[model samples]
Target: MPATPNSFSVLSHPSLDQSGGGTLSSPVTRPVPLVESTDLLRGSKTVGIMHNGSLYRLQATKLGKLILTK
Candidate 1:
C-alpha cells in the first residue's frame, strides 16, 4: 500500500517549510509541483521531486510514510 497525503497535498505536512505564505487552499507558489503516489515504490526510497529550485529525493518508509530523504 502507498501513503496518501491526509491533507490532499504533497506539501502540507509540518516537515515541509511553509514560510512562503501558501495555504491549504493555495498550496503552490513559484511553480512548486506536487508529488504523486505512483512515484513511491517499495524498496525504492529515493524519488525525484522538484522544490525550491532543486530536485529532491522523497523517500517512503516501510510504514508507507513519505519523507524527504535528501
Candidate 2:
C-alpha cells in the first residue's frame, strides 16, 4: 500500500549530556538506500531515497572504521 501524504516525520536524536545519560536506550538510526541497493556503491558516497521514500545523505564507511561484520 502507498503511504498517506506527508505522514512521516524525520527522526531526531537528543543532545547527550555528561556520562551519556540522555536517551541512551533509544535506538540509533541506520542509513538506508533510497532507490535501490545499486544506488549506493560500496566505498562511495551516496545520496538517495530509502524504500520508504525518505531522503538520506550517506557516505561509505572507511575500512578502519569497522571492527567486525557478520
Q: What is the lDDT of candidate 2?
A: 0.42
Clashing pairs in 2: 34-49, 34-50
lDDT of each: 0.58, 0.42
Mind giving the per-residue lDDT tens digits that candidate 2 earns over 1-70? 5644433232335543223776545544543223433344454545443656655555445542322121
Which candidate number would show the highest lDDT if scored against the true structure? 1
Model 1 scores a TM of 0.37
Instruction: Give candidate 2 misplaced runs (Cα > 4 Å).
Output: 1-39, 64-70
TM, every model:
0.37, 0.22
The alpha-carbon RMSD values of the candidates against the true structure, listed in the order shown, are 7.6, 12.1
Evaluate residue 67 in candidate 2 and report its C-alpha lDDT on the 0 to 100 scale. Answer: 24
lDDT for each residue of candidate 1 in 1-70, tens digit (9 for 90 to 100): 5655543324444435466534355444443456456555545666687778888787777897877744
